[model samples]
Target: MSKTGPDFYDDEAVFATYQRHRQRVDTANDTLEKPVILELVDPVANKRILDLGCGRAMIGKEFLQQGAASYTGVEGSKRMVEAAIQTLTGTSGHVIQQTIEAWVYPPEAFDLVLSRLALHYVADLVPVFTHIFQTLAAGGQFVFSVEHPVITSCDRGWSAETRRQDWVVDDYFSTGVRVTYWMGDIVQKYHRTVEDYFYLLQTIGFQLEHLREARPQRHHFQDLQTYERRKRIPLFLILAARKAI
Candidate 1:
């Protein structure tokens, strides 16, 4: 048995489990599902882009399709990097295998850097944010999206009955929290409250620009029941911040 969200990309069985759920929901087509970070990015033609933890290259693909000058994706999982490469075959892009903690890049090399639903997996934000700040060019923007701590705190269970409620946060500051995997096993996830995120960006010299809580739109709700519930509770949060010169 493995830990930490079943290593979804590396483990075939775990990937299958996620794929099944994703298929049921048709995640790729959900426009309201436009990633919070991506909305802020606004990739322009002929600009260099870096996608950390690129995961299957979905966001990177969008950048290429929108006419980014060039794209580079850095992913930790070899399998995922391969999948990204396959997805972008014959396209103008490069995918490399590396962990965010250890990856290195030329300073001020990219115009835009993006990571979606990936940074929270990191145990510490200091080094990662530092890396992003150093790697981005002057006036470059770093955009990212993460599961809203409050929403994830409730473990994907916030129905209309539970809306606007207070739940005991066992350890809001605990660095270690258990994340249940697809195989029903648990693993430690890094924990940081909303303040931690805000402070880290300020400390690293990033100017906060956009912040939005993404609630599944009414059209996404399967029925009346889900619509009422999600309206009061959002599932993800997207943020856009710029590195100051």
Candidate 2:
């Protein structure tokens, strides 16, 4: 749940539910999303990083610890901003409490820009991505992750029965706003196809570098069943693009 201003995460109950979800081992964020995102942003040393929708800034803390020159996070939720500040304590990192849509991007200021599971919450991507391209120095990388179209295409609430079976990827070609339940709250998310993402980046003048479906890996999990079940469908779509040098 990244910043769509006035989002469910701002609610205490939803925030508490999300914290508990993150604490559980083998969740998608830990086993699937984080590793892929880190792999795409390797060799963080000496790079200026800008994180959009940074929740708790946990990864920003890691980047700073790995010798990133500086870290800046933009978040809309006050609670998330406070948590991000604490997570980045003792490091040369800064956080700005603002929505990605509203943040004033500084031109050519960062070597890398990242967002995780956040863009889907944004209704308009062109303006946001244009800002990302403008803020990054030439050859800078932009890496991000979002809920896969298969998951976003349908809004059926999740349940134990559905968890054990294959997902129904209905209306996959249709793209628009979706209302779904997550973290014990109803949230609005935008649905876009894989081609839509690539097209937008290329149209925004970002050279495509890498695209991943957040594949399952053996080391990411301890249970064979969990690993096998994860292979059934792609949970996330990750992309890495670069501003031409």
Candidate 3:
């Protein structure tokens, strides 16, 4: 099971129990992911976009509404592709049901590549980054978000049951597969440190442009206690990198 990934998430139960919330960007994602990635990439008019692990392809709709030239979403689940298709009908976008790990990248084909809260699930990231590098046009930007290292570093609970509010972190620097109990069931996510990600990107011929560990606004959050706890630790890491022109 160590070599396996979370059993190809095609079922509805898995979708509900998986990472995404309410078929859209949830609090943590909207807070830490959207703002930072948008600020860096700015997917407006005349840009061709590629989305990896594109769940529901909701961003594709926003891209089209913003007058983007085109959008292609690669998703692993057929139902996710269906939802994306339903959401993206009559728009300049198409969702392909395929895993990003196996999908071939079209060389220098896209102006912008985006992945949101998806990279951690894959066991290896080096080849994927290489593909992203090759698929982007000169000066093209790749913006993505992944689960925070502290969050993925350990599975130990920070629950009230343990009488602890502080997160438990272990084996932080060791890179390997981690099984996470999220939403409801067990899911697999590979753990990678900040230095590991930075080194991979730099070695893959990507220039770092922006990096942010963001948090939600207090006013926007209703649960003060949960918000306070989250404020102390980041949930997501957003990054933007460019292929040299």
Instruction: Give me the candidate number with maximum TM-score.
Output: 2
Question: What's the TM-score of every candidate structure?
Answer: 0.83, 0.95, 0.89
RMSD of 1: 4.0
lDDT of 3 by residue, 28-62 (tens): 66655677777788647999999998888888999
Count the clashes in each prediction: 0, 0, 0
**Better by TM-score, candidate 3 or 1:** 3
> What C-alpha lDDT does candidate 1 achieve relative to the native structure?
0.70
What are the RMSD figures for all models against the true structure? 4.0, 2.2, 2.8
Candidate 2, residues 127-197, lDDT tens digits: the string is: 99999999999999999999999899985545632453757788988898887766666778899999999
User: In angstroms, how far off is 163's CA in candidate 3?
Assistant: 12
Q: How close to the true structure is residue 120 of candidate 3, measured as C-alpha lDDT? A: 90
* Candidates 1 and 2, the one with greater TM-score: 2
How does residue 23 of candidate 1 score in lDDT? 59
Q: Give the TM-score of candidate 2.
A: 0.95
Q: Which pairs in model 2 have colliding backbones?
A: none
* Per-residue lDDT over 153-197 for candidate 1, one digit per residue giving the tens place of the 0 to 100 score: 534432333334543344556544546343333444555677778
| Model 2 residue 190 CA deviation in Å | 0.3
